[model samples]
Target: MYELKIALRQILSRKKQTLFAILAVALAVAVITVMMAMLSGFQDELVRSSIENNPHIVISPQDEGEEFIHLYRYTSALIAKKEGVIAVSPKYLGQAALEYRDNAEGVSLQGVNPESEENVMRVNKDVIEGDLLTLVHTKYGILLGDRLAENLEVHIGDLSLIHISEPTRLRRISY
Candidate 1:
């Protein structure tokens, strides 16, 4: 009771100071609450984008020295039939040189089944122009990034002849 009376007396004596202190605390709480909300929203967006932009699982070649997975179709079918498995997309990734006219530029190449890739990668969102899903119906259709299109001086619907480079192979048996 005495301590409470003393605290009340001190607070009453410094009315402006007490009011300002209360206001300062409230303002601090408000600022902190807003910051926390913003941070939470930012974190949620980051997680969502990370999930959307990347595949949850990737199947790599068993042997690092091997350039290709020989039985990918068989493996993909088996994996797809597994329980709780959502999407299984087979992607062929390589480095190639594309040539148009007299200009040639080395580029990373990716060949994927548009239908299955759509289910796994959600690749349609990344396309700035043209339809990625349309490739399912269009046979021999290819998608090109802006940088690659610019490098090759090609436009949409323009039939630009491109040359792909074959990787040089050198095999030697260990004695």
Candidate 2:
């Protein structure tokens, strides 16, 4: 008690120094509080954006060197039967080149069952130009990204050629 009293007396006697010290501590606390709030807001936004853009879970082939998932239909059906599964859309991804007139651009092609993809991704909500339901009836229908469509100078009814190369063979398909 005596030591604390002596310390208090010293601080009280140096009024200007004590006031400056108090202000410095207050400024540090305010800056730290503001930085913490900003960090929390940033983290929350990052998590929300990641959740919105990605699937809850992704299932891929277990083998590190495997290029494709074998028996994907059976696997997908089994996964769908598990608890808490709302939908399953199996996709086959390939690299292809799109050719329209003289323009050619390489792109990644994804083959998906349109109805199943719609159930899983709600893709129809983002369709701006054509009916996604057309894919159900159109035997050779394809959906392209806006940037790809723009780059290829293609419109709704225009035909485009796709060339795909595989290890065993190369195939060209027109749509």
Candidate 3:
């Protein structure tokens, strides 16, 4: 009790020192609080962006030389039957060039069944223009990346010729 009284007396004697000490502590707490809020917000944004942009799992051909997955329909069906599997989408990738009017741009082409893709990827959510259902009736239809479409000067409903050259096959698609 005697020591506590002395300490209190000492603190009260130095009024300016006590004020500065309290201010410093309060400022530190305020700064820390603001920093924590900012860091939490940044972390949430990063997680949301990752979830929105990336797939939960990606299955690729085991052999690097293999261009296509064999019996993809059977594989997709098998995967869909597995526990915790919600949907499956089989895709084929190739390199192609899109030509529209005078503009031409090389693009990586991805072919996917509209129904399966919608079930797995929810592609309709990301579409900015035109319905994904358009591909169902349109033979040899394609969806281009935004940058590729911009480079080729093409828009929805516009016709673009796609030339795909592979070691085994060469094909052209018009849409």
Per-candidate TM-score against the hidden true structure: 0.71, 0.66, 0.72
- Per-residue lDDT over 17-110 for candidate 3, one digit per residue giving the tens place of the 0 to 100 score: 9999999999999999999999999999999878866668888898999988899999888989999998888988888777877987877878
Instruction: Report the lDDT of model 1 for residue 36.
Output: 100
Model 1, poorest ten-residue lDDT window? 166-175
> Can you rank all candidates by TM-score, best first?
3, 1, 2
- Backbone clashes (count) for model 1: 0
* Highest TM-score against the true fold, candidate: 3
List lDDT for all candidates, in order: 0.77, 0.79, 0.78
The Cα error of candidate 2 at residue 22, in Å, is: 20
Candidate 1 TM-score to native: 0.71
Clashing pairs in 3: none
lDDT of 2 by residue, 1-175 (tens): 9999999999999999999999999999999999999999999999987876566777877897786799999999999999999999898778888777787899898787888888887778777778666687766677877887788777777777777774322222212
lDDT of 1: 0.77
